[model samples]
Target: MIVYSNTISGFNHDVDQGIIAEKVHNELNQKGFYNSINEIRSWENSLFYMKNVLYSPSINQDLNIAIEYNIPNTSKRVDFLISGYTYTENPIVLIIELKQWEKAERTSREDIVTTYLGGSNRAVTHPSYQAYSYAKTISNFNSYIGDNNIEIKPSAYLHNYKEEYRSELENDLYTPIIKKAPIFLKKDTIKLREFISSNVKKSDQGKLLYEIDHGKIRPSKALQDAISSMLSGNDEFYMIDEQKVVFSTVKTLVEKAIINEEKYTILVEGGPGTGKSVVAINLLAEFRHKIVNYVTKNSAPRSVYFDILRKDKYSLNYIKNLFKGSGSYFNSSKNEYDLLIVDEAHRLNEKSGLFANMGENQIKEIINASKVSVFFIDEDQIVTTKDFGSINEIKKQAKELGSMIFYGEDYNLTSQFRCNGSDGYLAFLDDLLQIRDTANYDGFDGDYDIKLYTSPTEMKEDLKKLNEINNKSRIVSGYTFDWVSKSNNDIDVFDIELKDDFKAKWNFSNTQTWAIDKDSFDQVGCIHTSQGLEFDYVGVIIGKDLVYRDNKVITDYTKRAKTDQSLKGIKKNNNFVLADKIIRNTYRTLMTRGQKGCYIYCEDENLSKYIEFRLNKVLKKNN
Candidate 1:
């Protein structure tokens, strides 16, 4: 996935002609990327600065070079990569994160710094950590590096930064990452050159680069399997990028809170498959020495986690106490808990309790009751009217409680560990669902499988076949049916009755662990039973609530089952627009639950046709 690769001599020639930026842009265009003027100009300047560093004849001119090399299975790309052999003739790759920051300011938070970027002073990841993360991601997922013992050296080059203020970025808070990935300033030409020439001794003639480009990337571990293994002491998950930075940063903050009696609130925002739950569970495991609880408003994920731990034969009392509802903090005394790791924070309601009347606010109560509170939330994934979580809401609560707030890259998760690690898939989904106006989204670029079936029975049969490999594929639908089987004594009663004799019951009557239950795939799951969970593959049934009419996507609240609480009070407010969004978002969440693939069926033929058409166009573009 290296968009542009050449020897140092060839790269220098392009730059000497002042056409390196044009060449890079052309390479990117061939791969369906359109860079803005600013990015193009930055590439030009960064390459010029790199030219100075590589001018020494002591450096091998035959060293392999790459620009904008896309990480396998992920949409993220490294700015520059150099491949060669070390002095000992071992395969090595050097990752360089190019930056143009003239200055930066330190924040109270670890792993975060504020700098002028994108025309504003913004909180961003420290250059050192960013570079280290790029290397870590490659080593972890791209098994070629790990299996072949390829050493990766990561560093950041701030060619525009002055030497006088190096201490600002070299703060003690960032010492750990800086040690792993050093930072070079504008005036450190000799230093940077020495760093390169010291490691890269011999050229590989692109052999190492070819293996890197064609190497196998390990598939993402099944979410349920990973969580279950995590519950044991195995720790089968690896945190990458912000997941790593966020983990270390929060660990430090939690230590401060426990040792110094400091109160802090961290707000971590990320979309689906950003490994939110994985990170939350990692924290729960790390701080088990202290009184800690994994809190969430969703019972589906909790049930699945509890089941996973139960299989390990953890004590029943420990399981119950470890996985708690958001409502559990309503009546706790101040700082009663050492740490609160809240997942699905977007589903937290304003009030706590069965009837939503116990607490002033769930966010406020959690902060009040814990020495340190960590919230993992995604507002767009808020599928119900009851969801009260948002970036603004958490900050407001933290401020009101006089708690130190940790935001920005230090607390956010950005890497996509699902949907085959294709950010384009999520962007294409947003465009298809009309959730936002996404530009240039043809399709996702990954090995993720997406299929549209005209027949519901066909979808189920295929998905059921997939589930046979591992009990990790199941069918979920919008809340478009009632639980008739729950009320009937007849075991034959079905809750979901589709045309063409497609009949099934909801996972409601099944065990709480429907997500991983062996026979549960025979039943259908609603948004409640599937949210905050994932599968190897999923079959989604888009009901009559959503359809294509007159060349536009439409939602009909009346078509939804009356028992569904997702849009309960929205109709009363005549919030048709809001209801429409919920319906679309509900499906979006369901479609994305599959890690490897997704199968879809629509009740409306016209809707099916429209979706098939859109999917075909994307497939063609990707091909």
Candidate 2:
């Protein structure tokens, strides 16, 4: 939605009155979004300068301008949008990605430049491409543009950049995107006006933006469906905003690494459903001809993807070998491969192998085995005690390996592609688990089918019904129950037994792809088998490991299944801190596996009631 919209003349008056920034702040506050003081100040500075850019008499003063247009289903926003009609009276929108930079330097990576941001000189997405990607994101997901045929023009305006450094920003490496979405420096204000005027010569009463804002948002395809299409040599998941920026930046770095024989490491940090796997898969697709391996500590995702993507048994030889466990590279020679795209990098262990005595560090070994390494990580998903992956560890390894490192918004993924594109859901989840204090303590917005159930039988019945529709629904739980049938070849031995005759089996010991197994619905999955994957519906069974006690969420380490490996030795010297964290994170991850819905069955009545109470505050309907 447009936080603030007005005629060009009206915006000029507001800027002249020095209330434009205040208006934006007020509107964002009304929408329950947080804006920092620096962001408000930046808006103030940019709007004041934008007044000059829109002062041209040749341009239509009656044209509409919008500030901070919230893109549908994503946390990213358009900095500025001007809506008007083309010369032939067709509706069009100009998306301007505004940047306030005084100076910048060229990076060897294409579509990337080093600039001062966030208190450091970091590699950032080139402005023109950023603008283009934002526009493309809007067009791709917002159904209104395609339905109505409204034209979209994207460009970047760096009001503080000098004319002397024009050549640095105008590199040929970014030509294709720059040609599509031109960049305007302080000196090019008149040129920018001419460009804007050429596209939008008349006003359209701001109706186009109203429709665009209210347009229907196309839902992200199911993860397995997207992966199948992508593996079949089709571009199923289109990279949006930073996903595109990170993809392009990595491509450039890989090129440099291959041509110059240099080592480079890219670190991308994003929360769940931020398209980390999509980006990693796209990278593998792009570099399929080269020697590259897709690595992850968990085999669930790799196995499921291989199960879906493999065309036939004979075709699995090369494609199957491309996916390796994190421990596979421990003994590899230095620079043994070209690229190692590690997803769920936070789950990597310090040591490799089943005995955990092989490698000094998984991060160091992976980086050593590849000329260019890309790590997709979310620190919050480090649920196990052995998860040794972290930003500090990766940076340390890169430094010791003498590899160039890149990490920042330029490489970070922020869009919420999962959980129905509701970042509020994730924030609410964080607060629900008491993992972190957040503004979303009550609940989240969106039609995510979440319900707290007092009866495990009801939760499982509903989830099983959902599974019948697409086989995309499954039940997973915390490691509260032991695998009593681990060595027994019988399926009747139940590991999880709930009241009211509710009983279930852990996934069969030899079931490789438990996620998609046709008869797997009757079995239960744990954090190890459910991580790095998603489903349409999920029923989470919260165990006594976590309990709502004394008006707050608490954990009992000893309640965890004695056979569970995730928290091995976590209780040593009373390591309740880590145990508590892992327990909460496990439930959080389990509950979020559902794209459409999440049902909960809590072993503790207090925890179940607490969850129901919190969810009732935000969700209109709760069972």
Candidate 3:
């Protein structure tokens, strides 16, 4: 939906009189949209410059103009959109991204530029790339764009930038994006006008804009093809007997809910490596007619999935809509989505925002926003005190919302898909970690590979060797190292320093695709970046937060890094028990991230000896 729309002549007239900003603000307030002072200033600056360019005599005055057009099913909005017809009477939409930046610098990342934004120098998407991505998302999701044969062209206008400062914005690294969508500077106003008039010479009387605003949306063909390509020849997507049963049951429930116009909530509980994500992705691919989305609180799993499915430049736009964050439903309309498959529900936060006070509980909002909400959760994966997602909370919210709850063994996935499909390794780890005593702690004799190393250096070397055979191997550590270098450019600075010259840096904070980045194997991943993800072989570095003492496992919250927000304010006497649980849960989650083997190196010598003794005792008992 667009906040404001009018003919080109009307828009130019309003901007010339300095009343367009107020007009758009009033319209947004009428629609119950939040209005910020900065947003109003941006609207004033961008629209005034847009008016100056569109006022050319050669530009058609009857072409339709839309401002602040919201992308479908997302909170993102485009700056300006112009819809009209070309000389041959073909419908065309020009997506214009306006920036008021006077300066920008190149960054070491792809498709990102550093600029002064939000009171600080931060990295942001390049204007041309941003505009192109928005246009592609619309073309891939909006049914009208596909059915009506509308051509979409994207461009960026930096009206405040001077001609002499063009080299910074148009560097050799940005040639591909500039070629895809030309960037117009302040001195290029006449060229910008020519570009607009060349594409949209005729007027459509706002009919095409109206159609786009009220388009019937379905999964685009590109979305389906992307999913198909990702799932091809991947045996992991195949479901076993129990997983198939769960999938069939949930599919039936969703169909019934859609027909009856009723809300349904299904809680699918499983342990680590039980194919929860696999089932969620399969359902998303199968339910094409319905408005479906896959939600998660952690970006690790989502990034890996996107990196795999986004086969080409255009595929990323279509594939992004299939996944969303848990907090994306803050201001959503009730029952707007047909199905929301929430993966890793254990990571859902109670509140979301910079200060964590913007919205209500995410669980309640998600329940209220969809006709069918399927949550895939593993309660043991809640590694932080802020994570409050539990089966009881979901049931209580479902009961309060008057939605039918499907809770039973049929909805639970008991079969294991990871760790070489060995459920015994999971039970053994749980027993060894003292999270619970489900299995005998004598020894782990399962087919899954398990080893303990006294030196972190040797473990790293072994992991690197294993990665050569299969690239799906990484080293993960506890939250005891300072990651200050993550924000700084010195990502190569070793954050985790150990004896014997074993040093490694934490994973790059801006590395959205850390799971697939070529240089990430040398870095150590923390719990935040490794959870909800699996590797073929994993090397774990147990920090000093956990140690063995007095013939029992003990925890010291003080050993955790001050930068780690998960265990910020725990007193030894006041919250020791709870702090211990969270720390153990973090290590447990990290240890189980491997699907084939797990190698461990503990910081505390006592803890290492204790683990070795326990394993030897178990071996003796088995013999």
Q: Considering TM-score, where higher is better, how would the candidates rank from best to worst?
A: 1, 2, 3
Task: Tell me the tens digit of each residue's lDDT in model 2 across 1-623.
Answer: 78899999999999999999999998886665668999999999998888999988988999999999876555678899999899998989999989999988877665778789888877667888778777877887788899989889999999999878888899777788799999999988899899999999989998888888887876546665676566557766657667876887889878878998999999999988888988999998888888999999998888887887774442688766788999988789999889999999999999987899897889999999999999999988888899989999999999999999998767778778777666788999988888889988765644467888888999889888889987889999889898888877575778999997999888848686888888999889999999988887889999999899998999887898878888888657568788778888888888888877789989999988888888888654221
lDDT of each: 0.85, 0.85, 0.80
Residue 211 C-alpha lDDT in model 2: 85
Model 1's TM-score against the true structure: 0.90
Best by TM-score: 1
Model 3, position 195, has a per-residue lDDT of: 92
Order by lDDT, highest first: 2, 1, 3
Instruction: State TM-scores per candidate.
Output: 0.90, 0.86, 0.62
1 against 3, candidate with superior TM-score: 1
Give the per-residue lDDT of model 3 (tens digit) for 1-623: 78899999999989988999999998765543456899999899889899989987899998999998866533357889999999999999999999999989875444567788768775566788778767876776589999999999999999998677788889988889788888998888998998999999888999988999888754212122234554443322434434555676677778877899899998999888777877887778777557888999888777777776664443775667778988888898888888999988998988977677868999998999999999999988888877878999999999999889987665677655566555656777788888788645765433356789988999999999988864778999999988767667664566889977898888856687676676789888988888877787899999999999888788888899878888655663476777888999898888888877789999999999988887776556444
lDDT of 1: 0.85
RMSD (CA, angstroms), candidate 1: 3.0
